[model samples]
Target chain A: MRVLLAAAVVVTLITADLHFNKLSTARSLLDAAATPLYWLADLPARLGDWSEAQVQTRASLLEENERLHRESLVLQGRSLQMASLQAENVRLRALLNSSALVRDDVLVAELVGVSPDPARHQLLLNKGASDEVFVGQPLIDADGLLGQVVQVSASTSRALLITDATHSVPVQVNRNGVRAIAEGTGALGTLEIHHVAATTDIAVGDLLVTSGLGGRFPVGYPVAVVSEVERDPGQPFARIAARPSAALDRSRHVLLVFIADAQPKE
Target chain B: MDDSGYGYPVVLLTFLFAAVLAILPLPQWLMWGRPEWVALVLIYWVIALPQRVGIATALLLGIGLDVLEGAVLGQNAFSLTVVALLALVLYQRVRVYGLAQQAAIVFVLVGINQLICQWVQNLQGVGARSALFLLPAVSSALLWPVVLHLLRGLRRYYQVS
Candidate 1:
C-alpha cells in the first residue's frame, strides 16, 4: 500500500502556506483545549519549586532580604526622580502644544517553560492571546529587553530571546550614534553587530541600545556593550560581538509591552 | 490479539497522561530536557496493535502535541504523522527484532521524527538550530523500553474485563 500521507504534507508545504492556515487554526483550537492539562501538569513542577524554595539557607535568605530592602529604597528614589522628569517633559510638550504620548499597557507574565532544545533559547510566558497579548509585542524584564512574543496561544506565548540564533534587532552605539543591526549567533550570552565598516569608530565599551530605527523594539533601551571589537584588516565587515544586558539565563518574570498608540518608529 | 474494545480506553488514558506531561510547566532551565512522552506512548500502541491503531489517532494526538509544545499549529502534527507512518510500517516485525537491534532502530526512528520536526520549523520560517536538536531522539528512544513496559501494565490494568 502506497502510504503517501507524508507526500500530502510535502505537497501542502509546496502548495503555499495558506492551506496551512486552516490547519493552524484547527491546531490553535486544540492548543486552547489543551491548556487545562498544561496547568495541571505544571502542579508537580510548582510543588517541586515550593519544596526547593523552602530549603534555602537561612543566612542566604536573610542576605537576599537585606539586598531587596536596599534595592527597594533605591527604586523609590528613582521613582521620585522619574516623577519630576515626567512633569518637566509634559510641561515642555504642552508649551510646544504637542499631544501627550499614549503609554503602553503592559501585562506582566511569569516564565513558565522554555524551548526544549538546548541549541535554541526561547521562553514560554504565562500570558497569551487570552490575556490580550499578541505576537510582535516586545517583552521587557527589569534589566532591559527580554525578547518578543513570536507565537501566542490563548493561555500562553513564546518569546524568542534576542540571544537566540534566529533573532535580530536594530541597534545604535550610544556614544557615536552609529547604527547597526545585531544578529543572534545561536549561543547563550552573545550577539554580533553585523556590517560595520572598517573605518567605523567602533570601540570596546561602547553601549549599544535599541535605535528605534526598527519599529519592533522600543527606543533607547540598553541592548549590549561592545565587549570585543576585532577588525580583521582583511575582511570587509568588522568582527563585532557584544553581550545582551538582560540575563537570558536568569530572569523569571517579564512584562509584555503593547505600545498602545506607538507610531512606527521612523 | 485485538483489544480495540478494551485497550482503546487505556490508550486514551495514556494520551491524557502524555498531554499532561507536555503541559507541565517547569522552571526555565529544567524545561529544556523535557521528554517526548506522548509520542513514545503513541508509537508503542501503533506498533503493538496495527489493526487497532491507525493514522487519525496519530493526527489528533499530534494536534494535542502542537498545542502543548507551542510550536506553529501543524508542525507537531506533521512530524508526528510521519512518525506514525514509519511506526506502522515496522509494527508487525518490530517486536521480533532483538533488544540491541530494536534499540538501534528506535534511535533511527526517533532521529527521523526530530528531523521531520526540524523540517516543519523551516516551513514555519524559523532558522535551523544546533545538532543538539537530536538530544530528545536519544532520550525518547532510550526511554522506549520503559515506556513500552509501562504501557503494557496500563493496558492490563485498564483493559481487565
Candidate 2:
C-alpha cells in the first residue's frame, strides 16, 4: 500500500511538471541545494585550468598579448564601419517608418557543467537568476548563434543547444531572404529544414540567419549554412539539412544576449 | 554504533559526494558508461539501514537528482522509490548473498531505473536511441563490489550507526 502511494505521488509530480508551472520555484530551490555538488565535481577540471594558466611562460604570454592586440586593432577598425552602418540603418528604418532595432547587451558566462543524460544537449552556465538571466535568453559564441536559456536557478542556468532534437530556430537564406525553420536533428553536426516547397529558392551553401519572426532571437545572427538540399519531383516539400554555424561542440565561454523586448513569457 | 546524531549527517555527506560524481562532466565518448553513482549509494544505504533510509529519503534524493540533471521532474524519484521498496523487501535475502550475487541484483535495480527514465523521456516526446541507454546499469553493476567495499570500509572506520 505504501509503495502504491509513493507511485501515485510520483505520477502526480510528473503530471504537475508536464501541465503546470507550479513546481518551478521548488525546482529552483532544489537546484540551488545541488549547486555545491556540481562545483565539487568540477574541481578537478578547474584545478587543471588554473595550473595551465599558472604554468604559461612569460614569453608565450607576451606573444599571446601581441596577437590579441593586433586582433583588437582590426576589430576596432571594423567597429568604426559598423557605427556608420548602424546610423544608416536607423535612417533607413525611419524612412520606412519601421521600429529601429534595439541593441542587445551581453553578459559573459562560464560553462560550469553539462547535462548528464546523453539524450539531451544542455550546458549549465555559471550565471543564473542573480545575474538577471531569465528563461529564453539567447546565447551566442564568438562565431554565431548558440542556443537559448531554458531553466534558471539562483546561481546557475541550463541552456539548451540548437542541436537538441526538440529545438528549432527560425532562419532565412542570406542569399535570397527565403525563410524557413531549422530543426535540430539530435546529432551535433546537423539541423534539418523541413516542409520547404520543392521549388523553394534554398540551395546548398546558402547561409541561414535568424529571421526574428518569432521574436525569440535577435535578427540576422548567423544560424546555419545549408549543407544539403534534396528536391524530389514527386514530393511536395524539399528535404534540406544545414550545419550550425556556432562551434556548439567546442566553445567554453558563451554570451547571454539581453534584448529589451524579447523577454520570454513567464 | 548507537543511534547518535552523527549517523544522519554522515549519510548525507556520502550522498552529497555521490551526487557530485553522478554529474561530473566526462568526455563525450565516456558519457554512456558513467555509473549511476547516486543510485548505487542510495541502494547501499537502503540495504544497510532500511529503517533509516526509506521511501521518503529516496524520493527526496531522487528529486534532488532530477533537479541537478535538469530532467523531467519525478522521473528519478519514481524509479528510486521503487528501488528502495524492492531493497526493503529483499534486504534479508540480499544481506546473506555473496558479493557477486548482490551485484546481479544491483544490475536489475539500476536497469529498472534506466528503463523507467527512458520510458518517461519517451512519453515527453524525446526520441529513442537503441539499447545503449542501458549501459549505465551494466557499468553500475560492475562497480558495485568496489562501491560496497569502499562504503563498508568507511562505515566501519567512522563507526557510523
Model 2 — TM-score against the truth?
0.93
TM-scores, all models, native as reference: 0.83, 0.93
Q: Candidate 1, A149: how far from true, in Å?
A: 2.1
Interface RMSD of each: 4.2, 1.3
Q: List the residue pairs that clash in candidate 2.
A: none
Mark the 10 consecutive residues where model 2 chain B has the least summed lDDT: B1-10
* Fraction of native Cα contacts reproduced by each candidate: 0.34, 0.72
Q: Write one digit per residue (lDDT tens) for candidate 2, span A147-188.
A: 999889999988999988889999999998999999987777
Which candidate achieves the best TM-score against the true structure? Answer: 2
Q: What are the per-residue Cα lDDT tens digits for candidate 2 across B118-160? A: 8888777664467888999999999999999988888777766
lDDT digits (tens) for residues A148-234 of candidate 1? 777677887778998877788999999978999988876777899989998899899998988877678767778888888998889
